[model samples]
Target: MLNRANKLKLRDLRLIKAIAETGQLALAAERLAMTQPAASRMVSGIEQSIGAPVFERHPKGMTPTAVGKILARNAAGLLKGMDQTLADVQSAITGQSGAVRVGAVTGAAVGFVVPAIQKLKKTASGADIHVDVAPSDVLVEGLLGGEYDFVLSRIPAGTDPRQFQVRRGRVEVIRFLVRRDHPLAGPGPLKTADLAGWEWVAQGLRTPLRQAIEEAFVSRGIPLPDEIVNTSSLLVMFAYLGSTDAIAPTSREVAELVAPTSGASQLAALDLEDPIIINPYYHLISMKNQSLSPIAMQLHDLVYAALSGES
Candidate 1:
């Protein structure tokens, strides 16, 4: 029932977050440089404003109520924004360097963003580049919520397409990869059915590649084999493939770039011949409504140029 008129104050939000984190009024108050009584009053005011209790006062300390947890999460986001804004303002006024927060999918992070960032470091010596590699959903959500400046990911789905400005990047070729000595690594024409028995190292269930794999099996009337492992970490995937006989469906560009260099020299593509038909392209995505900073713009151009050849 809360609205603009009843919005919580910055101090109240901070106090709530502190209380949630510390689990004790005295500790939270001390951290905030306020008396315990004042901190208690602030929590009361917040609870009353929201027409619900925000915490459970326990004998040990305190625990956030469901409503309290929701508010605390939003408070964290708001505080992060405030902190970034202050830093940005200082950077602009003092001609000091600022940071570019970038989120990217595994393929793009490996294939383009990481290299572009390395090159950018030589040119923009003072700027900071922070990169996060996650699934497209996580990256897209962070980009839309202001947690990221931009994302190198698939064209975000389930939203208004026009709300985003997207630059075409590399098209990822879905490759079925395995260790060099895997049972299916011999000199014979590989068949899709040949992959039926081996355990799989899969991406998360909701990811685009995973979904495509699921559909491919369903269309062929084959139930997916029991996945031995599910993860998004490229390193873990490589390590697992190197040590085990698990098959991994991965982007061709990433597999090629990582296999030879990651000390997993025996890792190689299964000659499956037929490529997994999935939309494997990377896009440099940012909000249509948000304007990019000079540094961010420069980095964006670098990523686009680096990835354009593969599109």
Candidate 2:
């Protein structure tokens, strides 16, 4: 019996993908620059190696079987990875002036990372920037796994600080936001008690930011609101805050940038009479011992400077 891993080859995977995409053996064979008989033999070999029928043949075309679908999906991933590898090698040959992969938390993505990339592009037009916006914990995981060149987000608790080169930036003060027309919106500073009557939109319970907000309520002696909308999506939170009188706690930068662009532009930050004192600093983190590509290093510096308020 042939082992799955040992029998699989790059050319075979490519042929599988081409067959699945074209649906006709003749078309797929033409694309691969092979004779139809040779393509048929190749498909037969793959099926024999796997001990299963990979496709269902009909008069018009072919359809992938369940096993075939799984193989095709994996083939696509493998091909993509190979393409990225080739691109990276080419970038190395060209002296590191290519793609720079970066990840960031929501606040940094909007307030810092995007702006920095825009500025970098003016001079380094040859650079390709890919940015992922995710929660701090998720971004940190990507940084540690070598999926990202670096990340503009805070390191999670319990992570070994020695594993990363961390550059800490300004603390982002949390802001409580509500619609401009909300009943609690007024000239006088608003108290937590004033918000007790309204519903709230909150991040997922497991998130650090949500835990801090809950802590703030406990410290203020306000019974945590039982009525809450829990979600990780900022769009959903802002939509609820704008359309309804729901209150939410977020970074000041997020509240400022999202409110105007969200179409429901009536959202405004509240002046809390007793403000929540949760300020999480942003950190630019890269792998500890690994040297970054020159392009990636330049992009990292740009992001750090922007977040740190340096020229």
Candidate 3:
């Protein structure tokens, strides 16, 4: 009897569910596309296997016994789960549902990736997307370590270019940010030389942003700031600027994003005598041989289109 109970099939569950819903063997058989005689045989088999009478054969229709009700309830739940599982699988195949992990530098995250994600969500609402914003080196490491599906960053100088596929993105313009009440904030045409005396907030040495700032000062025959607070955290940078007269350099995109027109911003961009533009450094990159999931590929294409000004 135990072996017989273990042998119950999905079709058996469906037949029981149909019978419970319709409350008549003839009607259940019609719904299942089987003859009444065949349905009766299946019912007999189920009752025999479980060693119980599942239903009472009344003159008008069938009524479920206590055991039958239990089976019917469980069958409905199981069938509903099965149907949902099938739907999820179909959604995944169509690129409408899945997970995508993207890495980007802060500037690109603000200017490009954020907008692309907004558009993607409107169409593929079931797609799960994660965006990581960091410096170029960190983004590249995440891409290589399988932590990100793709990254918007430059390949580090010494790494093999052949290890990944790349599409060149736009150049980034760097702007100096200071507290709204800082001495330089009232600017009429301030040269790089004028910024030499104050304290400065900057990234660590050898990073691209740091290198750009150093070149900007050295090219103008000006000395670097006397005191420097080295950090990569934007929170720390903003906090430091809020209380002191220090200057922080950030991409124009990030500067504009954080400093809104509402005038509530604690930081404001310094209108420099000369604009500092970083070379076209960052790119849309992924491992050469790795294939992205359907959903990840969809998002990757969306970012690519945004880079090309197609979207």
* lDDT, candidate 1, 235-286, per-residue tens: 7888899899999998866777856433656787764655566664668899
Put down candidate 2 lDDT per residue, 1-311, tens digits, no spaces.
35754697888898889999999999999998999999999999999888898889999988899988988889999999998899777765554457889998787788888888888777667687899988878888888788899998877888888988988867666777788888876566777777675688988886666777778778778788878998878879877887887888887678778554336557777767666655555688999898888788888888888877896
TM-score of each: 0.63, 0.65, 0.87
Error of 1 at 127 (Å): 2.0
Task: State the C-alpha lDDT per candidate.
Answer: 0.80, 0.81, 0.87
Give the lowest summed-lDDT range of ten residues in model 3: 185-194
* Clashing residue pairs for model 2: none
Point to the candidate with the largest lDDT.
3
Provide the lDDT at 302 for model 3: 89
All predictions: root-mean-square deviation over Cα? 15.9, 12.5, 2.8
lDDT (10s digit) by residue, model 3, range 1-311: 56877878888999999999999999999999999999999999999998998888988888889999998999999999998999889878888889999999877888789988888888789998999988888888888899999999989888888989898887777888898888887747577777888998988898787889899889888898879999988899999999999998888778888875466888888757787778875899999999998889888998999886788
The regions of model 3 sitting more than 4 angstroms off are: 5-7, 25-53, 186-190
